[model samples]
Target: MEGNEMKAFMKRVDYLLVGILLFSLGLNFYHLNNAGTNTYYTAAVKSMMQNSHAFFYASFDPEGFITVDKPPVALWIQTLSAKIFGLSDFSVLLPEALAGVISVFLMYILVKPNFSRTAGLLSSLVLACSPIFVAVVRTNNVDSILILTLLIAAWAVMKAVDQKKLGWLILSVTLIGVGFNIKMLQAYMVVPAIFLFYWMAVKLTWKKRLLHLIAATVVMAGISLSWAVAVDSVPASERPYIGSSQTNSVLELAFGYNGIQRLLGQNKGTKSMGSASTAVQNKDNSSTTNTSNGQTPSNQSAAASGQAQGTTSSSNNQGAAVTDSSSSSNTQAPMGNGAPPNFQGGMGGKMGGGTGGMFGTGTAGPLRLFSSELSGQISWLLPFILFAVIGLFAEFRKTKKFDMRIKFAAFWLTWLIPMMIFFSMAQFFHQYYLSMMGPAIAALVGIGWTMLWNYFTTNDGWKSGLLPCGILTTFLFEALILNQNSQSKFLVVGTVLVGVILFILMVQRMKKETYSPALPMAALLALLILPLYWTGITINKTNNASTPIAGPGSGMGGMGGMGGMGGGARMAANMGFPGGAGNIAPEGAQDTSGNSASGSQTQDGSMTPPTNQDSASIPASAPANAGKTMDNRNQLNTALLSYLEKNYDGEKYFLATDSTQTAAPYILNTDYSVMAMGGFSGSDPALTPTKLEKMAKAGYVKFFLISGRGGMGGNQSESVTQWIKDNCEEVPSSEWQSATSSQIQTSFGRFGGETLYVYKD
Candidate 1:
């Protein structure tokens, strides 16, 4: 081939790759008009834009009263974007959207140097269309940014090893450190992968490698802990109380709540995992013991049931347990005919245990990713990738020294194996966290495909035979997923067609005794059809950006009732907190995956079903802080806001609530600060009785809003609720409806369906 021909060939590949990138951008930005799905972060973005203190502290409101349960880095980007773009939902989410596009590009570049351009493009395509990757990127969740930063970090380290450049190594760890600032300890999962890649691929002496790693670790820790240290350095009184901390220490939060809890699955409800069926019995025993406190067993049971039904009850039985007992109980709640009660019109909540351990409940094993709720979202191509990985390792078994491809493959395996185990065993995690596995999965898929392509096109009988077997296995797994989740015949038909095509292609290649490159490509394309279709469904069917998921049915493939396209289903009406897949918010708390407080035990390891949320809009698993659009649940009760503003005109806080949920939307929509009296999870002791008394006396706080069934915030939420109940007059919902009576009311009735009360002098 001549130089000009080679240049033209490269140009076409570049154009095709560029086209794929644009396609990814389009998918990410499709229906991107959400005013903010994750309102917890949305409110923070608003507050940060309005108040310098809020920006610095990452507070949930402009007054710097309390921060979100996360480090400020991810929100900082959104805040800056909102500041420049005028604080719309689109502005806040733009950074993540751009990150999604760039991640696809980076994945391509990452793969291209070691493999063919075709392999690079295919990997990028896989990453781009990955359901959860696309879903999270399109929402306000911090995972997208975290994923991007980690990808950049991986790229940097890869370059570091390739060029033996210390600068690249520093740059790599620094980016990982930045990711730590975005999501704290969750970002460090990839550190081992990075260190190993560098160690294996770099031509450094063993001692020098160890020394270099030590220095990298130091830099990484400094960057990772800098913000936590800074926030902790400030006196608690001067800065917003760190949200989601048991001891009000971010450092403690780093190690205990977010760090070890994730690794060991030492969540609140974990102790009861063996006894999930006996939650009621356990509650009964506890109630009997506490009977001397004037609470009868019947009353305790009633309160527990009421709490389960999202009625006006405060006590959480489980505290910070990770097991979904409420959801589990709801699952086991017998309606006489063996049917569970429909809290909403959605599908009954399916517990993790069933025949084959559907959602990782009954079992925690190596194969957890191959089955269950987590499987569908991120693990679709995982099995094929794993087979490819094994084949690559086996094929290269004779080589005594590691090559670039082998080293790269090892790095990805290092990345995938740990996370797979973590998610498999961890009692608490959301499906979106699986986004971390995207790059590794994509890399393996690319490497595997490239190898198979080479093997199939060549005259290697065993390799050719294995290609067909792997394709068959992947098709069967996908078909099983489709059958389990969708009522659409498209999946069934597609599966059959894929099988037929695979059979024909395999026979043609094997009979001719020669490899046809197009046949393998055709098989690969056929395999992608179902996931691509599912991705399309996710893009078009997803209404609530808060808990974005991919499937034929709305909201994480929960419903077989609303199969196929165009369901016209509204998104979740008003999810309370941090409500995404597997990331269940504690009762009356926002989703606090990383923070200790919100991640703390709810009374029971159960989720309150979002009342009247569109079944289509909620994820299969309701996350804390389920999404509510500005026009939907987020529209502040104008009359209520006006009443507070007018009556408490000069007050520092317009209103106060037990948790951020009751306050965040008001702050975001009204651009007025409302005090989160407890914190994000209503568990933070940010405001004690003394603090409240002082604030009330100072006229800095007033107009307390008692929203819904307030949590017994351990004692903090209960204390504040009691204080407001004793000192404040109940404000009827009718009076609260003075402003939006003619407009659209929230799904529950009006203005978040929260009962409001104003503090009286």
Candidate 2:
């Protein structure tokens, strides 16, 4: 413990941290350009880079017809990145990737002061390997940036608590307000946790604490609403229509479309994400209480002996399947509807009736996070988190006063528990949103493992049982998740074996009145192997940029082999992802819902299940932009791009389409302003016949990418279609579309076909 030795130890830790950050950088940046980009966001970034006006609004087109659905903070970062790196997929996604890397380092910084260096290091490592975290950051999604901002706030709060600085506390809340601009109410998800931790741990008079909090709250509200209020203050005639808002107001967009509607899964124009009760099951709704591997959740203690019954998986070296008897079936249930009635109104997700239920987040229930649809994305270490919480409570029970340990436990658990509740019950969310859980889970794992070892070597046999129990239980849970969802279900055995061997050694050493932390450290390393492999899958295979999810077969971008629209669509599907075997479900495809992965001709529109013997493709059959009601096929018609460019007459808008799905490819590929009439889901009532007629007459636009209400699902109005048909001339397919061009469905599934028209007075 002398200064020189301590300095050497610190040096080693720094080297290791640098190495881990390097690895994180590689994971975030590797194959990044080839990976699918959420063209919806990428197109917006393209337009945001055009000029200051579009940049400020996070406009989807250079003309600033409407803004992106969320606030502009994250997009603003992306815009600056594009400015520095130039407009390209890599530039657009660079901020997200860097954010992810910084968040990993922040995890270490946030944990090390309260916990130990060991806990901090382990936390960073765990976050770096988190599948969903890696998956989303690899895309153009805002979540990485959101998480990055939140983690910085967490660091500031730690400083606030540690240094007793009122200014630091204010700074923390101010940063949280900044996060609100990045993702709106999602930033508030962690607010309760932060405030509770502050009040409980700050050691001040309750009244002063309340006053300080009130002050912080005021600052947070001001910062959070700064842009929204500014934008709303502008006259409707001067500013673009607020995208995704029922009324052209920023506050409405915040409190409505991006707020409560998220909970109800009903925005305003799309399908009602019916609640959990409406889970669409196959013909067989009867439950038989079956575990795939014939093992029960409670019996996983055998994993301590490396003979955890079903821990032996032989299928493709996939990880082991944990058998939970509480679950009704071993089969991974495809996502079912999980929103309230009347909540319909997204870009494409059926408020009801489709298998891509509620953004493929799985049926809403207490166990939704463990559902196969989500487990691969974020639940790899979930059991560890649960056990960690229990261990902390038990170990710290005697500490009545709030110490740093208790304070941190409160911070991590508060941050973790509410998000668990939200994701478990809320209807509208993507899997990547689970990245918010990564830091808490990662930090808890490190702290919990440290505590687990401490109790294990205590010589109090009763108190020491947690280590074996934790290992066995986590192995069982992980095994089940892999069996039900992962292609690599056989990976469970090695980690279980290693943990079992270490447990045996620890017991023998305890008998001899000796202890070694190395045994526990080795065991923790073993547990991280599988998640690392999953991250690798995200780096190389996944290209479903719009709804970035990780794990085996996750890159189902072109839902029905509907190809990309242009070279940029390659950012979504055409990168040889497995799901695009074609419009036909590749011979043995099973829908994530247990239904056929692709839609079939059924009168009731109740997606039909596949035959029992059907094999698995990427797990979710309905997840890729089902929110927008479009099968996620980009099919950027280069010929169409050429056609429009060749006939360009210096118009303000090159092409106008019902929703972003149609306009995104053209916008990403060209500098031309392509107006997405209804915005993202094509459901926003941003424009009317009057607006369209004026724009057409003003020579602001010329060509219209017309589709029926079913084609692309956004604000495709009857009046708009009728007005276009009455006023414009239809362009023949031969003039632009190629003979061999397999038209990626520009419409929302089988509902409509897309046609081109010239807007002539």
Candidate 3:
């Protein structure tokens, strides 16, 4: 690479765009070699890379006993990357990091044609610097990839409008179907926007538009269901059990577990775990009662003990109460469905018990997304959105034909509004899922700023003030969020000072009748400072192993990113908030293990669920000084791996455990198959006594780690657990694990505490 070649490359390079993308690449791949991967999903990647069936099903382990909760498309990308690059933290996370960068670029290209290049850059830059967006991009979770797919679909929609080609429209919706496979129903968040834009912008006849729209929907549905239909059609015996489904059916999963349950905030499906037969769809608008300052009662520390166990099922309820240790009580509604906040199959949500709403999203209302619990993640530029939306349609009367700006604005609004409503009212959702609202926010802010500025310098009207108002209002909002989080006063002061100074400068320039772009550019940079720094702090840890939030102390991993970075997750817990997993059992239900799994008590004295999401596993790379954090948590033990590998009996599975959490470490650490008998949460009813007997007789599993609560499922799962205890021989932990590490893996919660019991014939 001589200077001449470099010079030639530089000349062809779109440096401004490349520079923004490079910064995004930096954020997404900054510590690629060192950062922790989400252990839960990463295990699936490891397993999916093992064989064709595992690959097709996104198996959580090599044995193909069960699939990961989400569809296989995103994991397919990661598995391919891991295969080509050789599995490692960096290799598995590359697709998402790259997707993050490419999505930034897509934002630019998507905006530039309809507006100015600067508008595109502004949109791209906002997205690139977004803390939550960067956080998700840096993880192995499917959200970023899902976002990338949706953005590509957006580009296709643009093509259909620009060219009036029905083929392009079809391609657009088809890509959306691909997105559905990446993230289940989340991909549909943008579908309405797409259809609205196409119908309003395309010049086709009304009948043609109707017919074309119907065809597009058909294509979208077909593509969306392609994998699900194929997987579901296969005999239950031929494929892995669907991870989150109650009935072992993909459609049920799509419409239920990953679908409505997300909105309902309950892991409802079975009558086994509680008295209710379905997920509690009845919304309890009563606030989750907790201690003042919004910390969970009895949770007095956020310091890292550095333990890393995955979310546990609520322990067998015995109706017991103890002093000095009980999860905070919810007065009315209980969001727990006997699983952790990290949704079944380890899809994590808001990890901490900070109350805004049921899941720390603030009480459901129009102001919900604006609440402190939610705003810090995605609302820095929200004030600008209103003015932008109104201004976007301002030029509609200037021409009889529909404007591209108007069309795009309508599409973006459609996308943002539905998502806003969902995030505001929906009970069950992770903060990172808010990334869906980001592109629209960025696009509108960019274009709206452009519109406002054009009017500010050239017109003498009320619209001219919107820019300064938007900037100042955003400044106030950022300050409020900072103040609420108790963030650095320096950052808050910086936001206000920077915003006020920019507003003044823009106002001065407006008076002077000069339209130089410097003020707007400076304003954009001013807005980016805080989210950028927040993104920086989040670069080291996986945030929460499952939830993957950004910002200072945003390391609560309900799905157990806590599983990967035990130290950070502990530090987050030490931040003095806890919520995520717990369950209340039926009265008189006998506890086989003799433990109680209950949450806070309500006014009527009935119990709510627990919300503690600290991890028991930490990356081996974590700072060694985090202390003896691995005791009784789910830390991956090399010695255990060596023992299982060395004691091979030509069995199909190296080990079988209660659920994926117990098996994820072994699957990710080694090539051997590890079976999670009850699937993701040990509640899927995936195995039966007959199946276990056949596997045992066939020598398919030589060992069973009966160390945790069997599951939150029915008689089938419990019966299988009993059969194992009765039929198999329990090996002493001293023979394999370190003497001090015998109880080295708490399954999901304290009620489901770790107790090492290895059973084998």
Q: What digit string (tens of lDDT, one per residue) describes model 1 on residues 98-192?
A: 99999999988999888888889888989988887887787777889999999999989988888887889999999999998888888999988
- Over 4 Å off in model 1, which ranges? 1-13, 264-266, 269-363, 399-401, 553-632, 708-711, 731-755
Steric overlap count per candidate: 30, 51, 30
- The residue-by-residue lDDT of candidate 3 on 614-706, one tens digit each, is 232322323332224232122344456667767877677787776565566566545567777655444445555655665676666767765
TM-score of 2: 0.78
Give residue 638's error in model 3 in angstroms. Answer: 4.3
Alpha-carbon RMSD, each predicted model: 9.7, 14.9, 11.9
Give me the displacement of residue 71 in model 2, in angstroms.
Answer: 1.4
lDDT of 2 by residue, 695-728 (tens): 6787877887765322112122434656777899
RMSD of 1: 9.7
Q: Please give me the total number of clashing residue pairs in predicted model 3.
A: 30
How does model 3 fare in lDDT? Answer: 0.60
Give lDDT: candidate 1, residue 727: 71
Give candidate 3's error at residue 503 in angstroms. 2.6
